[model samples]
Target: MVDLRLERVCEEASKLFISKGYARTQINYIANAAGISVGSIYTLFTSKKAIFDFVLKCIIDGNYMGNNMALPIKESDFASLDGEILNVCKELSENFEKHILDGDDSYDFKQMISDVFDIISRYGVAFLIFQSNGSDSGVLYAYYVQFRKLFCENVEKYVYNFMEKGEIRRCEFPEHHARLILETLSWWGMHVKYDAFETNTGISQDVSKNVAMDALLHAYTI
Candidate 1:
């Protein structure tokens, strides 16, 4: 079991690290934010790097491992498109499209945006921390790249399914489209939420989602 105080310290440190970056954030800042003494922080973590490592561990343990983003597509699944895997994919595609599309002409753009935002918001702080520390060499960076690649691949598969169903127009570069959508959602749902220097636009999540989805749908849909 995790100690309550230690958990509190990690939570506070995560926020500070997100907002201020690792180099800029200090133990004193985290200690104050956690409502604990500097000594208490030291007792729990030998150094700031230790606290960051713990926070990264917590994020991994929180199931942000990207395994749940999409079903694994086996080589055999592609060879036998009529296999059970394709059947499962079709079912998932139907369920996913149900919430986003109405016929082939209309879409619930706002709802799709909301769903994406909600999913990304769960990892907003952790993503911000990763972005801030992206230049560093470590296991965290490896996990970050791995998660991003997995998500992009998942989106690519979804886009390909939509194309096959004639629900969306075929793109010259489907993978690029997938990356764009994912990066856009990451920016709005995570980066903008915790930016330290940018002046807040005071834009609510709904409005941001509407605007973003509108532009993306315009580009991707017929």
Candidate 2:
């Protein structure tokens, strides 16, 4: 059906954009990848920019194919999409602070760990696309760098707070251990799905998160 091909166009275009970057991806290349004519692309998209905008909006909405709305997908404000990602980055840090209630004896580290993995799993596809397409000095890459630093800072805060309170097991080079825990969560939560070298890529997100959280808990607890 025309609608299915339309979806294919968007899906293939997204992959090309992820692999080749937006400016470098050609109309002919996208058409060929989608098994469609350049004219067919033009029938719906007024310009290559339109196609890119649609794909970007879909990615921001969730992942590959969006809600599959009717044809000639409207353009999205890049500022809005940019802000959405930036806000997510900010919220991750803020949420960590919210969980770190001073002297709150009932705070649950396992629940916090679960929530972070859920966020990563929910946005994994979009995150992966931006990471691959983002140039080293581009805004997208900068967003990723900001997120990494914030995540590390929060993890450090948690480790130090809990260690001082005699909660988590104290260890030599605690900062390094915090980094290790972050990497472990990152791998299983997000990167595992896309890791070409990972043999267990087929595991469900539930299984991945449980295993990752268990590893961190067992490794860090007394």
The best candidate in terms of lDDT: 2
Which pairs, if any, clash in model 2? none
Tens-place lDDT digits, model 1, residues 122-215:
6566667877787652455555565556555656666776677676788898888778877787677766656735636687777766667777
- State the weakest 10-residue window (summed lDDT) of model 1: 69-78
Error of 2 at 28 (Å): 6.0
Clashing pairs in 1: none
Give the CA lDDT, 0 to 100, for residue 7 in model 1: 66
Best by TM-score: 2
Residue 49 CA error for candidate 2 (Å)? 5.0
**Can you write out model 2's per-residue Cα lDDT over 120-222, one digit (the tens) per residue?**
7766656666767666225766887788777788778778877887878888998998788777887887777664366344898889998999988888777
Stretches > 4 Å off in candidate 2? 1-56, 59-70, 74-79, 101-103
Model 1 alpha-carbon drift over 4 Å, by segment: 1-12, 32-46, 57-116, 134-137, 196-211
lDDT of 2: 0.71
> TM-score of every model?
0.57, 0.74
TM-score for candidate 2, residues paired by index: 0.74
TM-score computed on alpha carbons, candidate 1: 0.57
